[model samples]
Target: MNQNIFENISDLITSGAFLEAEQAAVDLLEEIESKDDGSQAFVIFKFNVAGFLVDIGHALSNRGYALKAVEIFESLEPRIEGVIDPHQYFYNRANAKCHIVEQVSTFDLTFSSIETLVEAKNEYWKSIKEARKVNEEFPEQYVNLANCLKRQFRLSEALWYYDSIREMAPEIPQSWINRSEALLMLNTVSNSYSGKMLHEISSGYNQASRSKFLPPDYAAYYGEQAERFRQGISENDHAETKKEFEELSEYRKYCCRSSLTLSEHGLYCSCAGAARDNLTIPLAATTVGGAFVPQMEAVLNRLKSEFSMARRCYFEYTEAEIEIDLIHEECFTDLETNECLGLDFEKLRTAFRLCFGVLDKIGFAICEHHSLKPKSGMVYFQNFWQLDRDNRREKFEEIKTPGLLALYSIATDLNEHKNGEWKNFKRLRNAMEHGFLVIVHPGSVDDIFGAYELSGDVELVELDVFEKMVEQMIQLTRSAIFSFVFHFRQKGLEESVPTGPTVSFQRVNLQM
Candidate 1:
């Protein structure tokens, strides 16, 4: 293998040309097969070919091409095994099997013990030794070996791999970032890797992992998404959530009766791919410029129905402007999770859109005045409460706070009470903002868990965060409005100045 051709193959594989990558692998293999199979060039090409195949397989998996990835991994297994040791191919082969198992409805994965996984994992690194014996300039190979070892509970070995790579990776300085990430994982060795820690990984390691795993498809734009389903309590969101939940629940009864039992074992979904349709959401809100008073009022009414807080709350959505104190300003925060609700909306919007689609195909928009791009009669506010993946509504029943919704109830101080009227919106927003968008699907014990998260984001969060936020925001709003009214009345400005909802709607032209 000429050094130039070897480098080209590396570039192509890293660029995600998998078929081309396979052909490149075969080219290297054929050259070695016909002449000098044990030459220096043969050794270099075999190592390059095997490494490329594995990288391509990883790329395929990241792109959601699971079967394709499995095929790539499987195809490379036999060829690479012959050139390298059996240990080298173990990790990719195991990962391929794991992905396949993950997709199956029933595969009896318990039969595949962790010990077997570890053995395979260990072999994968052992092959790296053979590859390095041929040519040792490859820094990423060491990092890859470390990551594979780390996945199988081999923290020390993984760290050794990363540390070695750190020493060897001067050509690729990003390895320090990788080193930073691998170090962080050590902290995560004993603890759960979710919530704040998950954010750290996505922001640091996951982001770095993307560059390593799929250089061509590294996600460039990401931030936290707000889960303001409590805004569902707002008139617009409330009306939307209520109407949507009832309609979906009613439809659920019919769908439940329509279950189709599989010929093999379990019952097939009665939904004629309603789940598929739900994933492809469509937005229907009309965007016009300025005077989006009606939209705000509409949302406010629904929020009023859903939320009651202790402090004056402000709900902020970005348009051309940042702060528009028309309906209300939400000083939204998950006191429990300590998540801020005032992050950028664009990143969070995608998450809401995803969660909305998960909720029976509803789409959402946070229109500023009439600045919604196109005009339409209906604006489909996204419903995070939609149940599909695993009967999330049933989970909601299990996690609901029965007494908090009452006219007069004091449940904020209670640690066990399940109410996230405040925190859910903020935390969900935070999670979505950061690229972990699928949490809004309501397959968990709490739908509001999508908001601020509860127990654990991977589990659940404190109900107090939600309850207190709601309680405080409501009290604040009432007080703020009362002060506004008294001052206006005292100044005699009430007669001449505009009175009523601070934000009102009017027909306005959309700039975009």
Candidate 2:
């Protein structure tokens, strides 16, 4: 008999007889963990086994054991996620938890899942953290941050950020709608103030919005809110503001404290007497942090049926990490046909903005072309290069923000060309940065076109599906650009190294 259990279990872990393989593997892990029995390499190997256990848990497809797998991964993530490329693996762990959440949603689970946008909040923080370090997730991070803030009811600050993006990427239509939302909010808040305050804030914003493009109903809506704001403040009553602040504070406290959410967030804790009630069952004898929940098994099964998904995502991320341009050359989704783009500071702030100038005009002439001028209140994002910047240096960043805003203003002024409306890559910039872009001129074409089309018909609530599509496009575009830019970088031509573009883009214009 082989004394080395890991070696023997490795041999036994085939597609045949998964239960027996699982038990043997568990026994080996137990034995090895007891002594300082392996080198650092061996410890790394154990993590791989643990990740595999996660994979196996999915293969079993038993809901009763779902919580068990969640416990195992949650524990391993702190330890193992760091052992390798932590970002790649932690993202996987997050996805796994999300999968559990999605599955639980399908069933009448013990913990009632609320409509609170907690996962989106967590994701927003993670993306923002990434953006701060690399400046890679600018547009997407900005948009998501704006959305999360809106959800948390920070209307004023959210409006400021969205306004900056419209100046930066004016061609994107969603920014317009987003701006309108915030303006409308301010319009309501203005009712509490004197007419002078309303006149002051609404000066530039109101004039820019009066082009007859907005539907009559929406225009009137903005008017009503503005008028309401003027009435409330002169009387000096702040009941609305105080109540809103109080509610928002509670939301923040709930989101910030992990302890408050962990129990409900976890996959229905067995310690809560779920097993004895027969509310849960044992689908497989999986060791999950000293307890078992049947859904652990079910969650695992779901993951296995879709196991190639993790590799697929990593593969995509690898490709996208290459360049800022060529984003449209990538895949739209694992399944969709639309092309998406990614932008860096230089191209987005420079070349990309050049494209939006023409698109903005096209956007205004709704009858002339395809346009999705971003609604002002939506979101705008840009990433900074290094997260390691100290507080003093960070304060410098705060100071630089005004300069950034000024620079954007200059760019908007430069766009006063009254030629035929030309839609360049501005929409692509927003799509790359914000995940939503103007697909078609909402007023002109019946369908909206974008780097990725978000037709009103389809919904993208799950990050796995959305991320996979985005990452795949990012990867495909990156790979294509890297090979081309290996020796040279140009827009339409790549001659030396040969490969097809990951995605395709078309430059269209309509006379203003």
Q: What tens digits encode model 1's per-residue C-alpha lDDT throughout 371-423?
A: 23224434332223222334543453332221101100111111112232222
| Least accurate 10 contiguous residues by lDDT in model 1 | 260-269
- Evaluate model 1: give its TM-score: 0.29
Superposed by TM-score, candidate 1 places the C-alpha of residue 99 at a distance from the truth, in angstroms, of 10
Q: lDDT per prediction? A: 0.35, 0.34
Q: Candidate 2: minimum summed lDDT over ten consecutive residues — where? A: 259-268
Quote each prediction's TM-score.
Answer: 0.29, 0.25
Stretches of candidate 1 above 4 Å error? 36-38, 61-116, 124-142, 153-199, 205-214, 221-512
TM-score, candidate number 2 = 0.25
**Taking the tens digit of each residue's C-alpha lDDT, what string does model 2 give over 328-389?**
56444432223223432122223223223322322232211112223342222111211133
Residue 93, candidate 1: Cα error in Å is 11
